[model samples]
Target chain A: MAPTILILALGCAYNEELPEKDILGTVIVPAAAATRLQADGTTATDPRFIGPIFLGAYSGIDTVSFGYPHPSMGPIVTADTPGDAFPYGGTTVGRYDFACYESLACKVVTGRFSDYNDMLEYFGTVLGSPIQDDNGADVANGSTFQQACYDYFYATSDQEMAFLGDLDFALNADGDFEAAFVMPHTVFVEGMTIWGWMDAPEIVPANPTESGGFSSCDVSTGREFDQYDENFREGRVYFDALNTPSQYIYAGDWVASGAEEAVVNSPDDKPVVRLDFGFGVGEAE
Target chain B: MRTHGNLALGALLALSGLASGCTNVRDGFRPVLTDAPFVYDIGELRVIGAEELAGVDPSTVPDAVHYGQLGAGENAGLYGGATFQFRATGSSVCVVVDPEAMFWNKEISTQSNTVQYKFEDIFEDDGDLDLSAGLAAYYTGSPGSEIGDFSAVYDDPAGVEHELAFNECIQTGYFGDPAHAGRATVEYCDIDTSLHSGVMYTAVLETFALPIDDSILNFGALAFDGRCADLPWYDSNGALLAGASECVIPNEVEYADANGIPEEKAWFPELERAYCSGVGKVNTFCKDNPGAGCQSEEEL
Candidate 1:
């Protein structure tokens, strides 16, 4: 089927078994609450934290919770550079490298932003696109879409944000932030159909380097036919286009309804989204 | 005089029944079962070469394929899940056995080569009840007999104006386009073995890129005016596309239908509202179901 639009959501919540990590260092837990103004004309109280990623009503794939196998990294990190500090450093330096390792935990979860909009803004940064509103305004400052996503994320988080040591939502809520990267449904369809025709014209943050070199990755391409067909017609090629598209950038899996019943899951608990595609092998008339 | 009148009335009734074949199974319902293996003739066949195959691992062949059936945005895809057991003949069109059909009815032929079918047959496996049924549950009469008689009208993007009509029954055209109107007819199966009789019926799916009349708008109005209050703008991909519209429609008059409105509600305001209100709300629920909006209830 002409890859009809699919919905993939990434939950950005922290867990005990799996803590948020990056090139800089493992996430530092939070210590205190950061107060903010509430809509009820009163100050809002939060036991500030940032561990899990808050996911909207979409599903996750091509990531850990989605059953993707992790790649192994040989003894590379000595007692030196902490994993959290690597993502922000230069790849050529003695920083974290994405070249040697095929799969790393850093790509799974990152620090949490105060609200979900911060998460989307982070996505804009990673995708190298500027956020824009319907009226064509630069949405970086703040917009209805941004605020609504934040409110919805807070509400769905059960009013409790995740935190590690000092690198928690309470402390790092300022500026733009990101959660764990998840495969977005939009990217999958577009990537499959248009061959990355939608990748926006922007520069993604460069990878940090270390003595081990950029974390190893396996990226190759080839073709094959589906022997399942009577004459081995042609094999299907599947790509993970989630959270990665070129044009008309946006983020989160939440639908507009905002109905309380629509909240299916949180970031810690990844969602499952199925693609309904069936084949009818029947007569030809 | 009374006896003579009764005899004449009986004769009239019998004559009418014969003319329409109301009782003959072969002639009345399964007329296509005759010598003609193929029911609908191929009017216009255009294949959209695969430009880009996104996300598909070049190794695994797809179970189905959807080429550009209509306009730039118009498309079609084949669907028959794990239940798909038939093999593709490897022709421009493929053939397979209908497991769902066989499950419901055992008397029908199961030999893959026994019958000739096409993409239209996939709809029979219980997809969308309203859209998939075509004229079977709605309009009456033989679609094939009237195929050439039906007019094809195309509507523009605004969807209110009718651009032109094609005299021939084109199998494919830009769906909802102002310049095209005609139904694509394909055959499907309800497997019948010794245990049951399948629901064998021919269905026709009509498409138009834009609305031919105001009837289309009244069917599923999104109230783009912004006052959708809790409602959000989900992209065609089901991701939150835009935030709640800051521009709420001042009145129902300001409401115009967007694309993808249900056809049953395309006319008659009361029917349209009753049908669409339920659908619009359900769409929201389906969106929450994780890709459920893009599929049928059974698929979910």
Candidate 2:
């Protein structure tokens, strides 16, 4: 006779091998911008108001609203705001030490645009599907407009169109300025947009189209987009582990084409996405 | 059988706990090491003669060393003038001499100096280890003692070529130690050259010394130049000796051929080993057993 017995062990183990949640990168600004320029040029020696750059990343099918005239979609991270909220219980802000930048502190404002809907409502645009207004008439979405926009722009179905966390800039060991963004690995698909706003105003501007001539997220009557060249810089890149090298891109190139689609489609881990800014000190032409 | 199984499980759990608790988890992780060395490019080498020393208060010129009672303007000499590069590693300092440069004098052809340059022993620890304690110990020990010697040939204003030997060179500069922030001046005494003329010609030259700023520590190029080996070797009794025959490590081609390692991979370590053996004091094992692998005796 043979004794028959079965044993089963059921216990939860801590997942030490969790996928990295942040895309890390370095940001190198001009020496002049790093030194004296304040957020508003009030205290700057150069009076350029180009100090304390604001950086953000958007997960949409299109790159249209990533820059200025869309201040309602506030910056998710800035030097002042730490522990700001983001998706999946993550902080909207990343790590930054003022000392690394040769400054005792930095002054910048965090935008209110934390997710996709806030961006769409502010821009009054949609992505794949058209939503009916109170009159049952179809509203203008990204697809119908035939304008340059990404598919993930206004879709709420999946995690595709989500605001990636904001990042704070700091100087690395190599003496280069850098910033890192923490977002779900799912947001790194093709058509991701990374944007930076140098010398961003402390107050986000009002959107004229909204009821009361102002959007809910508007903080004040903002400066005109044409007034400052620091208004917009956008790039389309799929940042994953394999493509995770510090990228040197110019801030003046408003529509910079980054990594190729084929490379972006390939499977890889989500590592730090290094972004170096080539914007030197001067007025925008 | 059940009791035995429980006992085994308990022992396993205990062992696991002990292993996890006792071992340093941080040691298991690899630390980020910087490759660039702390480069102190001499912006200007201000050489003041003994006569200039007369007008200035001795207290004001803390680095002023009296070499010889040489005449004023005639005594000031420049060897490897401005842009002279001083590359500091954790353990040794290499005064790079560009032979093609005008001040170095092409006629001398880069003669080797017999003085070995080293930081206080505390810097030799692993790059990942904190060096604050070592820096504290060094600054506290003898802040003004001569760390090494320097030698070069310079023609005086009279066009007479004379070998400039700084036997008592005191390194003074703000190493930017957290405790000490002001300048720690470095004064090199031309003792050897002064002895010949019976005139102590101390040319007090100012240098932007080591650990340029406070935030950086143990930062510099890992590879020691072959010219660094030109520092004179010393016997066990501190007697000045001639150049060691083993000082010449095999070139990349020779090293590759003998060990079957590719020259590309073998070159850097071989070059460093050659420097260590040439200097004698940095790595004694490399000096004693040149044929062995690049591991220092301390490492073995």
Candidate 3:
């Protein structure tokens, strides 16, 4: 009834439109080999080759414990942008856009990450969660409960150094650097769950990128599980929780004992690793 | 008299095990190779929810039964039933079917509503030497009559300790299969369900998550290596769950028992499918319940 109120109401009813179009791009890397060929022509010898970059929107779903399909965070996406065909590392999984919301909506969806960049970023986030519980780490697989690391990801910081693409295990018979073979696996970052493969550089390399990612990933001198046992045992080895809760994080998937064994997949190909994962990312030596 | 009795028992078992065999995973043992896709074994089953499903409520039962008994990390949706997976860790739980319980040999009376049946009449005894007491296959008298009476303890993220007790008889058998020993799968099926999961999922991530033709239900089974005779069924006691039976030479995979019966290894057959009273109730919810919209397994 008031003129100011009526004018405000009329203004509120106005709608704005913007022109937008969906963009498409493809990463070409045919000829399946140990080395992942990227569309940028830069071979992804690291685990980041597996795409589906997950940008964390929230801290985590605060459930008392972590279970399958752990509570979802908001605005999650498996693609680089909405509806773009992301590059796939393993070649077995396809591309898709995933938006899982913890509130009112949660999906136990499964897919492989198409790029390694997203995965490295994710690892950085996990290595950085304050107050991670012990059971929150890999349990049921026979590793005892440790107090400091709490979970498997941080407990084995030195070993995960390889997962970050710092260590290179894939090699040829001649002892030359072979292309790194990666396997997509299900990982839990705080509450959001995604299917990403673990990859670490077998060789120590000069660090690069915004935060330069992780240093443990560089194992150029060759790695021996024996060396990292104490580091992993002591939880304080790899990731640092010294950062803020938002920056802190822990993440990784269980190495498949059998093809059908890993919650990741059930394939007839009964290998030491489940079909969802691959061999050289560094299995329990 | 006791010495003579023991000697006689030994002689019988010697004659009983005249032959031994091996299992060929390719020939038949693979659960998927079966004609019907009953996700789990039907014989050694435990009926979980009494009509109200009050026993399995996560709120009341803080202790959780693991889902990877069959498949690892993943929940292999059984044909008889699917899973109740949590959105959090992908952890899942399924209907708690008693491993010792079997089907009713003879037709029993059905209550008019059909949804709820008298538990007493539903279970019948298998004609095995061990299952003697009339209706012996099932625990005496009531559902909780056979006191498995075991407790499982867990500590939460907050360092808060939690303990869960067995409501029914349960005994763990020694499975010679690799179990992938250090791995996390039950080497068979893991279908989980929960009240809070929001979705009643039935996807056999490791095996076959395909749909079946009709309604799905849980069944019992006697899963042995199929090499020796079936594991002698017994009431749930420390001896049974702990694999401490005379018929079961827990020490050796191949050995003879006191009864001259080769302590042949036995187990709940790989999880298969079966029809139970619960099917009716589940279907009722699927049909009337808008969210559940129960469909034939084929539709899953």
Full-model lDDT for every candidate: 0.22, 0.26, 0.23
Writing each residue's lDDT as its tens digit, candidate 2 over B1-300 gives 001224455556558878778653433332222232222222222332323422343122213211110001111121111112122222322221111000001122235322332211222111110111111111111112211123445442223334443222222346522321122211111111221222211222221222211211221111122223332433334343332112211122222122343333343334333343444344343345443433443553
Model 1 agreement with the true structure over B1-300: per-residue lDDT tens digits = 001224555556668879987864423211111121111221221211122212223233222321111111111111111111111112211111111110011123346322211001121212110112111122232333222112224332212223222111122245533232121112121111112112121223222211222111111111111111223323223333222221111112112222322353222223212223322433333333333212334553
| Residue A233, candidate 3: alpha-carbon lDDT | 18
Ranking by lDDT: 2, 3, 1
Better of 1 and 2 by TM-score: 2
Q: Please write out the lDDT profile of model 1 over residues A1-285, one tens digit for every residue.
A: 333322222233333443221112111112211222222334333322111222211221112211111111111111221111111011110111111112211221223334435533433443323344334444555345435334523433313433111233333453222222232322111111110011111112232111111111112222222233312111111122212211111121111111222122232333221111111101100
| Quality of candidate 3 docking, DockQ | 0.01
Tens digits of per-residue lDDT, candidate 3, A201-253, equal: 12212222122122222122222213332312121111211111112122222
Question: Which lDDT value does model 1 have at B17?
Answer: 78
Give the DockQ (2 decimals) of all models.
Answer: 0.01, 0.01, 0.01
Error of 3 at A140 (Å): 42
